[model samples]
Target: MQKPLTDFPTGSVVRIAGIDGGRQARSRMLAMGMTPGCPVTVLAGGPTGCRVRVRGSEVVLCCGLAGKIMAVADDSDEGPRCNCCPGPRARAI
Candidate 1:
């Protein structure tokens, strides 16, 4: 059920499965705290780019970069879920 980040609608919560790109792309994303298995929420999107919340920060990514991020919908009903980068946290914008 993996889909590109750009493919997910705004307000969707998904878990990053993998990144499809070169080493540089992977490294940049990792440094931005977008590691595999981490939860990400789509904040807003348009034709050029989109904003997403991950690792306690909101990031704006262009379509190219966002398209490289593969994530799966987090539809699990399990309570209090946590993962590699810790579950979503609340932070003031």
Candidate 2:
């Protein structure tokens, strides 16, 4: 089963399952390279907000916005690679 974005703690690597939001919100997130199947790293988070690295870019999302992003925690040893921005090696910190 997938978990909400907020459920992942800092330093967790996860794969996006889907986003639950209106057209505008979805479009904005998609435009920022937050598409399904991409790997993201949770950098830091509070009760209602968090910062994540997506496709080598930092994105800040509030709890309301984050709850809309569903992801499955990924612990594979394979290096992280976002389809949107491939080539760079990603190692868990």
Candidate 3:
């Protein structure tokens, strides 16, 4: 179920499961609010990088950084609510 963040498509809602990189990468992501269990919505992506919304803030990550982020589909009943997400079943992916 876990996959690199870059594997997800636009509008997909997923949760951060872990980081695949070293301490520095993890620390940087953490400071950006990309911690385990944090919800992320893929706003847009390509081979180079992607944009995501985390806890209401938008953050851009290069492919290398995004590849270091392990994520899984968010299947909770409540999911993570946001103006963009709207509801549990509103995900575009």
lDDT of 2: 0.76
lDDT of 1 at 43: 98
TM-score against native, each model: 0.80, 0.78, 0.80
lDDT of 3 by residue, 1-93 (tens): 788899999988888778999999999999998877677899997668889998778899999999999888887533233344455444433
CA lDDT for candidate 1: 0.77
lDDT of 3 at 41: 90
Number of colliding residue pairs in each model = 0, 0, 0
Q: Which ten residues in a row have the lowest lDDT in candidate 3?
A: 76-85
Q: Model 1, 37: alpha-carbon shift in Å?
A: 0.5
Q: Once superposed on the true structure, which residue ranges of model 2 sit more than 4 Å away at CA? A: 76-93
Candidate lDDT (C-alpha), each:
0.77, 0.76, 0.80
Which pairs, if any, clash in model 1? none
Task: Give the alpha carbon lDDT tens digit for every residue of 1-93 in model 1.
Answer: 777889888988887778999999999999998887677889996557779998779999999999998887766433223454433642212
The candidate, 2 or 3, that scores higher on lDDT is: 3
lDDT of 2 by residue, 45-86 (tens): 656977999877899998988888877765543323355543
